[model samples]
Target: MRPELEPGHVAVVTGGARGIGLAVVEALGARGVGVLCVDHPDADTSAFVAACEAAGVAHAVASLDVRDRDAVRAGVATAADLGPVAYAVNCAGVDGLHPASGMTADEWRRVVQVDLDGVMFACQAEHDLLAGRGGSIVNIASMSGHVVNRGVTHAAYSAAKAGVIHLGRSLAVEWAPLGIRVNSVSPGYTMTAMTATNPPEVNAGFAAQTPMGRLAEVEEVAEPVVFLLGRRASFVTGTDLLVDGGFTAW
Candidate 1:
């Protein structure tokens, strides 16, 4: 049987408004876990939370930019008021897919900032929240971190995800003493708002290339994330779990 999370234990999920992050929130919330939905100021999380309210779990929404360290810290504090933030997942990022040649310096910075630096800022801010509780941290990476995609080119996105993997490993080593486990999850072509932006040709191509011959559902990717955030993964850290449909293997 799978281990169950305790009640009143809260989690912080960046980009919790939709996609894989939204799925994670719903999963954990259904298990009686309080969660803080942290997303960009422009993201309208109000409706998402209203829908989740039917699940009968406590939740909060923080409209803060991950690039701002101070705002991240404040969000952590706000979440702590609800309950101990026993789990945190940095899922806020953009699929900055553009040809390397046409990708301007600003575009590169934006991708790196959200994908890499955002994860760092979140973990740093949560240090105090997870210190005594000895919780879990999961950084959302991508299969692009391991293998380059054929149709899409996102040098910054891939590089930053690669950095996210290493960042979790490095932090796992340092935070182990504090009983904080840090790990990463990489997904290939999953059905989410991010992938919905792609053209039909691009989506079809991704499906054909996957060994599974299909794209993954959001819940499929969120399950492993929940596992890593729970007691089941108590001894697991510093590892990258590929939730890809054998995309990297192929």
Candidate 2:
């Protein structure tokens, strides 16, 4: 296990209250790493709090929107109180389903703000926390960034995620001298609360398109994130790992 992943070291995970973010928190807790969960003010964190207690790991919650720069900085500072902050995962994001032709400016801005801008704000704050101490940062991007989904029309989401993938590479270069490695994980269709709400046939279509013939599990995506955040990936940086069940293989 990486020293950064061992017990006593803290990690800040945005969108930690649910979905992939929550899964990452669980994975980190199982590794004995403290987690500072940053989510929207209105997000329900009961489950997140319970998981942390069940895992018996040090945990804290910062209820603030990631789009706000000052709020993100304060959230990272809050995580610093637990111990040495060594890792961070930015997973707070929103999807835009509207087609590019009919997408309004506000609609486009909303998705880009939360998906791309949010990641940037979180990264900036996390960088400050781990600057001299050295650490790892993983931004949760999507395979949508790589290829357009067969039946989906989310231009904004795809654009924002594409930005995230490159953003990690750019930051990795600039921060390497400071000992901070940056990377991204792109997941295929995953069964989460949001996806679970979709019609069964809708999900089946997703499965049919993937070479793996199935959607990815939340845990499946979480493990790679843990690996990237640990010492095992010590020399790995400026890359994007696709945990997409071979969705892009074809």
Cα misplacement distance, residue 242 of candidate 2 (Å)? 0.3
Candidate 2 contains a number of clashing pairs equal to 0
> How well is each residue in 137-168 modelled by candidate 2, as lDDT tens digits?
99999999999998899999999999999999
lDDT of 1: 0.88
Top TM-score hit? 2
Please name the candidate that would achieve the greatest lDDT relative to the true structure: 2
Clashing pairs in 2: none
Candidate 2 local distance difference test against the native: 0.93
TM-score of each: 0.96, 0.98
* Candidate 1 lDDT tens digits, 45-110: 965596468667778988999988899988867888887779988899998878998899999999
